[model samples]
Target: MKIACSIHACSLSCSNLQHGGQRLLSFPLSKQRLDQSNLRTMPKRKLSQSKILGCSRNPQSAVGAPRAKNLKTGQAEEKGIGKFRFWTDARRFKGSEEKCIVQKALYEAGGVRIGGYPKASPIPGPLGFQRPEDWDFLWAPARLALKALPARPGQLVSACPGMMSLTRKRQLSMTLKGSLGEDLAFSIIPRTFSLPDELEAFKKYLEKQRSAKQVKNGSAAEEEAAGRCKELAVGNSAAASDRNDLWILKTAQHLGKGLKLVTADEAVREAAKRRLKSKKAKPYVQAQQYVANPLLIQDRKFGIRVWVLVTGLNPYRVYLHCNGLVLFSTHQYSSETWRTEEGEVALGHVTNYAQNMDGMVWDLKMLEDHLGKDAFDTLWCRIARNTAMVFSSALPQITLAHEALSVQPESTFELLGLDYLVDDQLHPWLLEVNGTPSLAVEHEDLKVEAIISKQKNEMVSDMVKTLNLASRFEPRYTSLRLAATKTKSLAAISIEGSEVEEGRSEHTAVNVMSDAADGQTTSSDPQEDEEADIAGVVQNSSMDVSTDGEVSGAAVASKNSTRQHEIRDAAEHNFTEESALHVVSGGSSKTVQTVISPADRIDHLRRQLREEMAPTTDKVVWFRVRQELQQLGGFQPLMPMFPMKSKSDQNVSGHNMPWKDRDNELVSMLGKTARLNKRAAIAAEKKP
Candidate 1:
């Protein structure tokens, strides 16, 4: 059958991109208008607008609905988002009635929530601006991550981890942040005022990523800058300042967060007012220079959301998580086109999940694979370090400026939501820092929310482990203390052997005494008069306690002390060195003893799990390709955990492709035998 090459082409999707751009590119908007056959002939008279989101709507039924409901549904422009809540640091208004204000159901149509709450809000505060304080504010995740790490300088004595002496956590955090930002500028970031030649040089990255197929997911960040997308130049001197302020406004109305960007045209203003239902519409900011060319992915602009956890304040530490969401614009990238429209084409620039739900790519692997693993990994590391440096540079000033925001560095931690955009050179530019970055993903689609939630939970779980919150709940310090006590008992057993052999016992006594000097102790050996003398000498000084002919009792005692200390240390080390130990579940309750390193034990258990989880050899014929994945123990892809019905029904609830359509492959995964069997029986029943 011959397929029609019109705008309303049937049965075509993003996968059809391989077919060639001619059929899919020009008529992309045709799919939205296909359902509005009624308004085609009477385009202007009918005044019909398709929903910004891809949801189908009944025009006739919706005519009876309230206008406000329709706007809330976002059928006229972008899909309407649910009630939004905003938090303000009320302490800024300490003298006034408002200490901290939690405004519920915030409408993000306007560019600034600057003075909306508490009747009359206070002037610029730490939270209002994406100030350095905001970036360094949340310390909990960082604190937890620090605690979780196996290696450390020493015990964290003060509130802040690795605090040498308690004095100024705030000042330290601020100073570190400032220094980090500067370091990034020197090492990774291109100078903001780099000449035109340098600017053009960086643009080469745009082509690189395009060739690599690294980006191309739909993009838009809902509230990166008050619900609008902002172009943040490395230096404030760039002419992008005006355009930055303007486009951020366009995101609200054009992208569907709040309202559309209003132009000076009186007719356009009147038309927008009809949708807003306000007497006089909010005036648009004065237009200046348009943000220059933006790097695009497959003819589409892109953006990313970065997260940073400041683990400590005293010495200022930062944790940049390895994974982040890459968003793409729905409309193809055309700086030429968006520039003419006065920043109204949010679909071409913004990349918020709500704005582009189908475009969200959670896994970092896709990008890494596209950009060449090494290149991508290197760029990724640079981005993470840059993030740390940005806030670190600002930390000192931030802490000094906000004295009221003080907290016990250890007791509190802050997580910053950093938004970013990459230029042609692949150099990432920091857009804005959100102190209260929303851990929440509020969306009409449950699947979108679930995906975002899972993504967030993964990061949170990592942060928890990094902070070592598990150790906090576990009785680790107590165990270590007890082990210290047991250390002395070990000395007693070794000291008895000292009596049987003077040379050996004397050597051990000297070692023991040396250890006792360091605060660890061993029981006094009553039988060896020489050991007592040796112990005293070893404890007193580092000088040798033995003479050429006769061994000093002080030196002998020190040797015993050292031997005892070694035994206790070994016992303690054995308890903590779990890298070689593996505990297997046995059929019986009997305790089994096996000597193995933690690594070997882990490998053994993993091997067992792989075997247990592995599909039977008889049934493995169907999944020969995924056999390696089953055998390997790291991250593995599986079918959607949702019901099979939901997996097939993307419109109802499920992940985007290829995350959505892995059921057949999932049937062969480990621990999926029951599901495979159930599906097999169903298939057999339908075979007749």
Candidate 2:
């Protein structure tokens, strides 16, 4: 047997040399010629095949010849046909190179490779060297291969470089394909571009196209055009109509004197025109010219003016700035009215002093003066009518002025500020009349700044407005009269106790005299007489009596007369002691006895002497005689009623002379003697 080898001189040598032995296989003679010829003519194919098989052929040698190599002992056998190929033993492809070709093609075209011992040959791990051409070998399992790569920007770019090129749209489309080949191709292209500008342009173009299309659709387009046209027409129409109406109204107003166009509607205008024409047809009267009184207009009644007392120069400027009334002195007075031009008025001859005083004072004075005498009189009367003088220390000048006005006969009077300057002697001078006096003195000590002046001005103004002068003065006179009546009534009711007591004594004397005149008899005994006299004196002293027995009028007159007489008598006697005694006796006694002729006086004296002597001598003499007899008899003396009757005589007269019986017998004897003596006296007088 024999086999040809491409090495230098090698040949198959497996022949048995017997009739039954198999011959060693040899390259066909024709196949060898065809290969030799085709190899020379197709050098590129052969070189490609050589590269595929992971072997190189010498460019100068014939196709079937193998390149020389150093033969080392125990060199490892080549594993596969290509750079990334490996050996695999399988029953299906025993000793068949075609099977290897098929396997390499499938692996290169992204197919799985299957083979060999232990069941399958180990595929290259991810770290194993890979041929650039064998990248598709991993395509079937590239997802897993790619996952195994480090997740870095460069690695990702290497794995799927085309991803950077695929546009956002293309990438999305490719992603939808779900095919690894297209996805890989799509991901591999570079995507560098001006992305932002391109996108903006693209969007604008798209929008433009859409808008163009929308414009072509005439229903919406025509409607929009019509709407715009209608808006413009309406605006123009409204403007023209407004202008026309305004022009018409202005023209109508111009043509019709003092006429106003009140309505926009033509119908209303026509109606108004008709009414105006009708009104114009009627008669017209000229308006009267108004001539205001100069004095009245100049007068400042009820007007409030504010004054700022400034210390600086150009006070008038400040006043002018403040809108104040100003006063200025001038040499001449003007008689012309407001219509005529006249110079300043002389200060000295200013009839209204109020006009001369500037600022708030001027304002007040002008107000009062302008009202004139009659009006001011009315105003003052109204103010004073019910006003009571309110005495308050807070406003001394006002209170004093009020007091003075109250005492005055005129019910209305002007208020004045009397300033006192003590020039050696203290006397108040009439500084000025304050027709509109300030009621507030509370802020007198404040600084004279603009603010304080303004405040004071405002306070005074407010006071003027709030004050009801008419209401304040109405009831003063009535109240004063009532007060006076009360004082007089009190004085009239007051009385003294001594005067009342004297009146009572005089009344008692009268009572006693009256009782005596009534003929009421009393006992003549000496003790009874003394008791009566004491009673009369006590009653006279304690009782008040009038001579005429009346409490008023005639009784008082009689009493006064008696007192006058006593006084006269005392005066005539030069108040001698005896005359004083006589006067005193006249006041006490009811009657006085007078001395007449001697015989008559003698008899009266004899009777009075006998009456006095008998009571004393008889009582003493009888007590002594009774005591002598009582010692002889050792018996008590009998009581006697008759002055000289003895107890024994009383017994002989058959009187029994029981001591009580003796008293009865003596009483009877005294009665008989008194009768006998009266009878003897009567008889004696008859004989004479």
Candidate 3:
């Protein structure tokens, strides 16, 4: 049986009673909202691997050349923003599989979101990592997507496992190693969360005067030379991203939520003490890259909670979820703002949703009312770029980690929460990435968390349907489920581990896709019911197969815009020669030099799903999103692409950015030919 519980928002009984230690801060328990329904949980799990043997390539850089006079993003006299254009599918097949394509493999970074008795064998730790059930979860920021993503349905596959390790998030390979290395495969994954020592070292790197003289050797210099960031700071004019200094000062760090702000001089000693109190023997409060002059909500500080789904590494496949929550601070923001007698800025200064739920708004309704659609979107794109940067930095480490552990590509996935804070100038600063973000929706603001929880449920549900984890995914043959099993019905199981209606029609399954839905399915025809178990014999080409499993008329012509996972191209997708890889799976994922004949992969997908879909073309119809994307709000369904490319492929033709990112760029690129460009120019000239 499935249960859906809603919690009413309760006022907090929290106060900054103490500074550090377990008494750092305390909250009296509000009445629990769950009764027969106490706490609700979003069902999810994961799988993933990495590559390091020259296999990890740098993240694909944004294609647009830096505009000379683009909108300034930094707090200081507005440094130039790296306004990149969007990238089109390098190659999309002209006549593709939009017909037999069941759905995109839409998973959150990587994991299984369906809750219950795990259908697969249990791993020692969460997602195969060495984490204990009662493991001390260090505090971290929860991130959410600031942009809309392409969404579809199959079964369930999530990107960020509830517990995340940037190492797993940035893996660069999908292939498993075959030979046993001389000793063992050496693995090293980079840390997404920083320790006190790393923070100190980073600070030194930022303070140029000492950075150049800190007795740093060639290796240190080389490490610094690798990709990183521009400058930024809390002081509106100070360089935030470029600097080595931390703008945040915590009197102590042991206090997870009880963290106190400190000055530069007191930071080092307090951090040391905080590290000592760490159960894992590490510092929990490291210097956060300061977001100066942050964009505020109703004069109160806030942060965005975005979710990113990463399916594989090497060819890093990323899916940014469209819907997310905007959290606000309790107190109004002001540079001159501080507490009584003490120069401390409490929750108001920080945008943590958990910290400042009192009187804070949920919908970005406040921000939108203030900045309007154009400004908010531009800010979101900047956040997306910063997010990509974070992944790019960790790519190499993740690749190596995967190689060392011999992780299989399709076997693992991760769902990560990406937190971001945009400055007043609309410049976004990276906060911290959380490994396991709380999926429970019973925080102080119950009403808001409940809404967010519901959205998450829907997002995960669609994702499950697309991945076929509910019915088809077999843990043993993880990667080639489609290739391994030609005839099997996942309809027997749902993500929540509930029994699915044994003989339901494909159309019947859609209505009951929710966790609360009883897995009951119905069919109009009895003959079709008998054939459900026997996957219609898959021929070399789906175009040749009819609804009754016989040869049909010529295949319907498909449009070229169908999009699939960045790393995975399965189910309903048309892969051009560039996208399809020839695989010879015999206990190994060996990608042959040549491409897999399109007929084989696409046909295989058709055969497996034949039992699950309707004969009508509606089974593979596209969804439209121009306002709020239950998936990208403004995206056309035909364009399976996010960050859609420019229709005119001119050198000067700017890449079509996700709607928000494209607003300003649209004017810059198409302004000349656009009739509205003159009005835009006049408006620009009018600005002082």
Candidate 4:
């Protein structure tokens, strides 16, 4: 059922477009020639002369030179260049717009030589085209119609399986509440109940509220009759009696389509009637507590549109766009106004850009300017924490879905649009998760359109960099492939032992240097000398060593080095006693029982993956990708808060960071994985 087609580069309509008077190069695109596996083995061919260098042409340059051109500047760039292809099933997107945007993005960020979907001739039966697996990258709708284009291993996908569970209103509400417990879920998101299914529970909630109200009113009346109530307190009692009874009813199937506010009593009555009259028991609507006291600007309510990229599951890797859009409602907001029909006409409560033609929006920087620096920082911290928690809660289901699909976790990624409504307390409440948030903007205002376009472009570019879709930067993919194909699988093997050895090597080198400085000869072990020589070379590359044989560098690095030497010396000295390390002791000599912190465990894992398993590890790949992202003029990472800690725990050891807000679940999962991998690696290393 899988068809593989070869798309020739010469067939592209835009192939001859003028690029700074120098024509952009196009490869054969023949599957055998362009496929990554065959790229190195393919026969070399001469490249034609460019218009820019028409005076002289060198056929030899075509064989070894990088010829990929930048999509924006049309200049030949040597950095991160590779031959990659992209395809789009634009049925669900804005057809031509989706194709154009993706094609350009793939050429620029993907490092694809020629970016375009293969044109179908007057042919039948899949148009004699390639299967989804053939393409380097795919852009499909959020529906995830796998049957139409079955998900295959090795192919990069736009959507993740089982994403609808988080995207749908009822499912998301039920999942979050079930996984995180009602208390935490209700605090993060509004208390939500799926209709029909949770009708009895809703009724009980209403009944409890009514009973409490009746008791309060009766007590007040009794106090008044007994002459215990003061005349001035009557107004205060009446004011206190008013409750937040407003609830929003949203269609489970559609978002921003049929949203309306209803009172608790009215909702209960409707639920009761639906339970009695309905033949089917399917959940059609969800009742959520409306956020009446929303954080507003210019007296208008707004909701933040967060763009989150989920690149992994289990220990999920999330990168949040720090500069997400802040969508503002066109009309001024007031809880009292929403109660009237005229207020509903003004659409003062809704902040969805699609619903309002003249919607006002601001990127995070603009919002930061509106709110002072200190206030913005505080607000952003909470938002980041809440967003991480939401994903952590959904980790179980996402993992199951990923397993069911039988695809590599690294091969799949999902871009989610997480909306949040901030209360007056600046606490952001989760609104809804979008599996395939739209990138296209249809705003009439040119300024708004320009802002959205810039943000979208930057986000998409960063996503490309993060995923490493380009062939040359395929370390993550290559490591995974090697692990998959090996008979003795090296999957998830920890390199902690290597790291521990490295530390010891550094300690030995420092000792040797100190002894030499004191005019003393140290041990003449070849390994020790080799390590010391390597360390000296690295240090000398950055800065000069002192004339008196003293090491000198930046104050911070010098201080950290001193701390490392002290810790290493102490660990060695203290753990030498057999009784102190009796549990891990084996064979003749007592073993050193140094605590492998979470950071050390992760570092070991990354190193082991690179040295033992493949040339580069996922961590190394992510680190490089992060560097690319930081250089961009857009959002920054929000998860994996302390990436540098994995390299050296000393980097963030003394900061008073909010430890309570850390993703403990992810950290725990990583630690467990590292331990298991370490055991496996040690066993393998011991094999004769």
User: With candidate 4 superimposed using the best TM-score fit, by how many Å does residue 209's alpha carbon deviate from the native?
Assistant: 1.9
Candidate 4: residue 324 Cα off by (Å): 1.3
Query: Candidates ranked by lDDT, best first?
Result: 4, 1, 3, 2
lDDT of each: 0.35, 0.24, 0.34, 0.51
Model 1: residue 316 alpha-carbon error in angstroms? 1.6
Better of 1 and 2 by TM-score: 1
Question: Could you give candidate 1's per-residue lDDT for residues 1-688 as a string of tens digits?
Answer: 1122222222211111111111110011123323444323433312222211212222221111111223334453212111111123333322232211111112221111221123242322122122111111122223222332221111121123332111122232223323443343434332221112222332343335333433343332323342222243222232333333232222112223533432112212332332343444443311111234566657776767766664443333345666566666667764333333343444565555557756645445656676678877676755765564455345434344223433332333455566666776666765445444545554455665565555565665555444433222111222222233333434554455554335434434654564467553333212222211211111111112122233456765786465344333433343223323334435456766554432222223222222222212322222222322332222222222222234447552112212212233443343466578799999999997
State every prediction's TM-score relative to the real structure: 0.33, 0.12, 0.42, 0.58
lDDT of 2 by residue, 213-289 (tens): 55776476764564345333322233321322210111111111221211123212232332333533421111111
Alpha-carbon runs more than 4 Å astray in model 3: 1-194, 199-246, 249-258, 272-275, 278-285, 337-345, 364-366, 443-454, 465-688
Question: Per-residue lDDT for 351-421 in model 4, tens only?
Answer: 87677655898888898999989988988888887776676556666666766766553456778888889
Model 3 CA lDDT for position 60: 20
lDDT measured at residue 423 in model 1 versus the true structure, 0 to 100: 70
lDDT of 3 by residue, 97-173 (tens): 22101111212211211111121213211221111110011011212110001111121123222222342222211
For model 3, where is the 10-residue window of minimal lDDT?
A: 130-139
Model 4 vs. true fold: TM? 0.58
Best TM-score among the predictions, by candidate number: 4
**What count of clashes does model 4 give?**
1
How many pairs of residues collide in model 3? 78
